[model samples]
Target: MATIKAIVEKSALAGPRSIKISDEATFSLPAGDVFLPAEAAARVMQAYGQAVNEKVLVGMVFPARDEGGWGAVLSFAKEGYVRDDDAQNWKADDLLHRMRVLQAQSNPVRKSHGVPELDVEGWAQPPTYDTTMHRVMWATISHKQGEPDDDAHRYVNYETVALGRDGHLLLGVASHLAAFNQSKIIADGLLADIDFDNGKHYADFDKTTDHVAEYGLAALVVGVAAKKLGLLAVFLAFVAKFAKIGVALPFAAAAIRRRFKKRVPARPVAAVTTDRQEPR
Candidate 1:
């Protein structure tokens, strides 16, 4: 097992690199952040106490700014073309309620791992979909159960998803409530830079020949995607370098992904280099 430093040393500093995820999608990784290939990323995750036990491919990590620079990458779930014709303008209350239900279902797992039960406090950004971009963006603010309902004690998970002709690309960032705004901006920007190949773009889908995903855009927000893709195992972990939030909680998020691996089947994500250039 390589040390974290060794892994980072060997990884590509993708200040401006184009990443292709198994031909399903591509990322024009913007300036600032290193990109770890699967093996190296797996090593880093193990060092952080998570076993790479999921059937899914090990995901690339562009460590949050404090750890390295900051950027993003997406983990592709080749479920199928997601039908979005009728999926528009979902209510925030409905989505948040679903999130809370998912949280309740997972509290037992958290307790088993010696982590405190967590509650979905509210949204840092309401569930919103961008029709032009073919994307869905939402963020949840959560707190350890039994904690006071205040910002300083909250944790933020900002999520962004880009749909394709195949499955969808999941990109996200986790931070304390204080970092939510900056993190959201970065996530939104990163999502905008990713694209699928010409024949693979969401608009390229052919109803006569292509398959559609079981869940629509809203499931991506409320955790229903967890059942089909089991994306929690591929979650991005953020570190704030001993942030001064008014809580005694640990700096990193609880290993939420580690708990859901048993359910989602595996799919390998092979990063094929299609192009590279300066960050435009």
Candidate 2:
């Protein structure tokens, strides 16, 4: 089992923050103050390819041996705070509601691939890591281009919203479905691992000493970050590639065997002579 360790820098936050993921391999970000699992990073790089730019703040990939793997990404607003207007009615549920609408309207992969609208299975504002974190669990059936109707893939996604003590917005998402029931387990593990520096937790907020966030927690979910980052598109792309492997693995195995056989030359057999005739 591998683990991911993210040491959040004091510069990135008004306070210190850190997180560690168990059973996953971690990778450091080029920008510093951020980290992600190596597998998730690879998937993000593969999905975005050359299009990936500095706009991507932090990305994580969770590759489950089972069917429930997913990817997560976090990006900061230029202002580094949620907008003032949106912060007024800030609530996790509202942000989630707005996100669903945005996905229905603007997700490029869903629009082009004709993936069905996201169905909300459940949601909650759970208290974990000594901070209140909002979690949304949803499901969707995505149709592959040219695939039979029955071949639609069922996907489950769990999105989490939290505000760092320093007023930084953080989003964590884990996607899986019926075939991948352990998504929640993985998501919870991640949430529990978060450790805010002595003065950087939500509980440590000080209006006098600490800077206040311009936007509310709600803005973190509904803001342009999701749109600009293209979270759903990146996630779906990962799923497509994951599914593609299932289909291609057998062919790939066969090709490997063929190549192996071709690479090894046949051993020459030397003639064997019988020496028993002298005894007779």
Candidate 3:
């Protein structure tokens, strides 16, 4: 659809560019990547789901030969400094159950919007927190209800959280099931590219003065599965995989007024590319 192209066109950067990830960190996006600022990034998110209050930034499109490019969205949650002591006792089985409950609760809203309900089948990659990097990344394999659990209809929601003294940077990488592993490598690389400012590092959290998020890292996972980013992820899953085969994504949000009907052909959206070719 021209809709997808028009929204995504005109924003490709000839990078090695520095992007401000909220007010907390700097993202050194590799060369030839597109960077969508917070406001522009939020508009893209709103197109797929409900209104969002989170600070959105760094939308990059990776070209995939001819299948069209898949991309990722970055959001920042300033929920104060999050304490990660629970990582030692993290129980992913329990966390997965909680995510499923949240998904069920959101099904009604999904149905109302003409979006098919999707269930969390399981982790494409289990939740892992890096003690040294102070970041967490996970991926969920979700499929449309009643559909066979196959890559053709599978949606991989790969998410990464980079903790900071003030809050955390959220990266939700959307990709086709077949592209999950490659996308994970890219997401991990992007995570490594982020850096906190002088005093904003997670190590700089001062229990005496800094704010601590009421919820732990586990709660962050559950909240993301049911809220703003969750809805965006679902639509993106459709946009990423369905669009690969040229199916038109339904645009149904009252929040989106600028319409695009043009479909941008897929191109290489890898983190770095020497060539600066536009999408076909």
Best by TM-score: 3
CA lDDT of each candidate? 0.56, 0.38, 0.63
- State the lDDT of candidate 1 residue by residue for 92-191, as single tens digits: 6676777778778877765675546777667666655667667766667677777677776676666767788988778865656776666665666566
Please, what are the lDDT tens digits per residue for candidate 2 over residues 1-280?
0111111111122111343322121222221122343344544444443134344355453332213445555532233322233333344444445655765565455445444334332232211121233222222222223334342343444444444444442444535334333445544444444444455445555656766656554454455433433444456565456444432112333442342233331122221221121110
lDDT of 3 at 27: 85
Is 2 or 3 the stronger prediction by lDDT?
3
Off by over 4 Å in 1: 46-58, 63-73, 146-149, 224-280
Winner by lDDT between candidate 2 and candidate 1: 1
Candidate 2: TM-score? Answer: 0.49
Displacement of the residue 160 alpha carbon in candidate 3, Å? 1.1
lDDT of 3 by residue, 115-223 (tens): 6787877777667777777777777777778777667777777787889999988877777688776667666666666788889999998989999999997788667
In angstroms, the error of model 3 at 12 is 4.7
Leading candidate by lDDT: 3
TM-scores for the candidates = 0.72, 0.49, 0.76
All candidates in order of lDDT, best leading: 3, 1, 2
